[model samples]
Target: MTYPHDPIPDLSADRAELFAAAAAEYDRYRPGVPPEAAELLAETLRDLPDPTLLDLGTSTGQVPKALLKALPSLDYIEGVDLSQQMLDQARAALTPVLGGCTLSLVQTSAELYKPLAPLPEEEWWTPDLITCCRAYHWMSGPDVLARTHRIAAPQASLAIMGDGSLWMHEADWTRALRDLVQQFLGAGRRAGALGDCPKPVRPFQEELADSAWSDVAEHRFPVTRSWSPESVLGYLRTTSFAGADLFAERHAAFEEEARALLDNLADGGPLLEETAFTVLLARRRAGAR
Candidate 1:
């Protein structure tokens, strides 16, 4: 939970390529898809003898990690992402437990990976369940969904999983944490690998609605995640903003200040916050309206 180093910032707006540079740090800090969300996908695919799962934005294989845990029977999972660096980390993470199933990692942005292509005769089945974890906002959602509609099996489903960002939380402690970061890094926020992650331009729902994958259903799982000051401090190192890359020579000073800030906020115990696990599933249907 604790890291001796802070995350190095990359500050590049190339959303497609932003994550790869911090691939190691990201794999260390990024949380996997929530259990409830994974269970939902598993339940939906329970009947299939051998399921194919395609993970969009499959950074470090978190999507497959979650899905395979829930549905170990899954036969193949292809994780597609923009960064080869990120996919490299994913390859290492998934190599050990691949067992009977195959874990294929393809490095390409979601936009270009044509999900609409016809199924190969001898190779495999269509994706029974496709999952996109935290990186949904980075994609051309309508295009992705439309293509998914074309390539997916008859009853295929898509699960988009996200909680909220620690930086974006509006709680008192979160406010205090942001204030500390701003004081140290100045008023402008960073994102991707540079600074703080930005809020999406449009709600994910709107994107889903605009596409053919409109049989939308949503589930919210209330969760209270606990963070130790040390772990929280470690997590910051992996963020796009606030990561060690932003401060350069002042990184040490910034971390020192952050530690003190966390100590004050911790008062006498660990920091506990109410967080929700959200999974938005979409399928293709005629009259979902």
Candidate 2:
């Protein structure tokens, strides 16, 4: 709970577990990564005929699903997360696409993952690509990146991705939604599982600069997600801070008021929002430690 690297140390790990409590809601309502971002990820690993990928903090497998669809050449993918419930949804949703590639899920934190290595008869396998979509901030920044660099293949590329979460954006609808959440959960945005989530700075580029994955490049893609008022409410329940469990005794009241607020913000229809999805690609130097 007291991560030395965390900008705000008071944010508890219990807050991060809220997503596990609302795992179903999270699977059902969280936004998907832009398809183009997945394509760019594929391009970044173009040389590998059958790239093995690791999805860090792979919540409900949204990004993995997109990558599977766009990067047909990927042969193996491991979805790692701290919550088994979240991994269950990911496995269920990703089961349909297991035809050409092998899919595996590990209920663990990224900072501690050592790939498949260090286990007897199961040698450690290096991934050609590592993706942490909107999850890097939730991790111990430098530690995870360092582990990723260690497990990655010499030519492996780590993609640290971000497309702002719903609670952090500043659109008119988003601001109004924030106000609604504040009314129930106070002024702070609820992250569902990760407490009082603070955005992680671009730690990878800085960390990678001194590590094996030092060649850095960034690709940005514009994305717009349209959301109905009801959908917004559903999404909020999946978040750590605004989750129903967080509301405790006031959960029902919170939902009712939130629905009402969203309905008013809807202006009789869905809301359109645009945000940038960015991928910071860092490639490991050949044979470098």
Candidate 3:
């Protein structure tokens, strides 16, 4: 497949390293793609005899692990991420659950990933389903989408899914936690070496408007998550905004304060978070390929 844009620098290095130090904590504390969202993606693959899947930004392999369990028809999967640590975690987690399915974990940014060519007499190895869960915001959207369109099968479907994290949620304890983070790390959200993570200039729907993958469907799942005071501390350590590196020598101090604050807010009960997981499923416009 030929690319229209000029060869771009490997920008995924920063995104990959953003969570490198917290890979294990992230795998342990982060939530997987909700079952309903996984089922929605699985629905798109049910008709295909042997579906191939590609997951961009497969941090710790949560999305693929869930989808593999949900869809037995899924025959092969490839997970791409720039972080070797993250890829290592993904491999360990995804291998045991693969059953008869084949798996590949590539350490590269989505924008630069090129699918391996098929063998003689075979066509290109295009994926039947493409998914980017919880990690699309860090990517080069237009470039990645264009690359995704190139390597995806003609009838393939793409799903971009994520939810607001605890830092962005609206609750008394969360609000207090954000305040505490700002007090220590300043106002803007810390995103490792990138400083503050920038929000996409436009939403995904608007971004997809002129792309080949213009046929779109939106699905939202209401999710309720509970976290204990210790769990909240663990989750914070895994996030870019409130990670331990940002706190430096004050990491333990911040954890102490955060634990106290959360404990008081929960009053010995689980801290409950009500948020929505959103999935934007897209397909190529008929006759666009």
Question: How many angstroms is residue 68 displaced in model 2 relative to the true structure, after the best TM-score fit?
Answer: 1.1
What TM-score quantifies how close candidate 2 is to the native fold? 0.87
lDDT of 1 by residue, 166-206 (tens): 88777888789888888878776777443454566888888
Regions of candidate 3 where Cα sits further than 4 Å from its true position: 1-12, 117-123
- Candidate order (lDDT): 3, 2, 1
lDDT at 19 for candidate 1?
A: 61
Which candidate has the highest lDDT of all?
3
The per-prediction tally of clashing pairs is: 10, 16, 0
Q: Over the stretch 1-289, how does candidate 2's per-residue lDDT look in tens digits? A: 1112232333345633647777888878888888888888878666777788899999899878998888777788888877767888888898898668888777667876656433467656788889899777778877877788767777777888887777778888788777877887777655554556565576567776877667889889998888987888888777666777778898888788777877787879778878898888887666667
Question: Candidate 3 lDDT, tens digit per residue, 167-272?
Answer: 8899988999899999999999888888987867888888777788889989999999999998888898889899898889999999888888988999989999
Candidate lDDT (C-alpha), each: 0.76, 0.76, 0.85
Highest-scoring model, TM-score? 3
Given candidate 3, what's the lDDT at residue 225? 94
Better of 2 and 3 by TM-score: 3
Question: Which ranking of candidates, highest TM-score first?
Answer: 3, 2, 1
Supply the global lDDT for candidate 3.
0.85
Total backbone clashes of model 2? 16
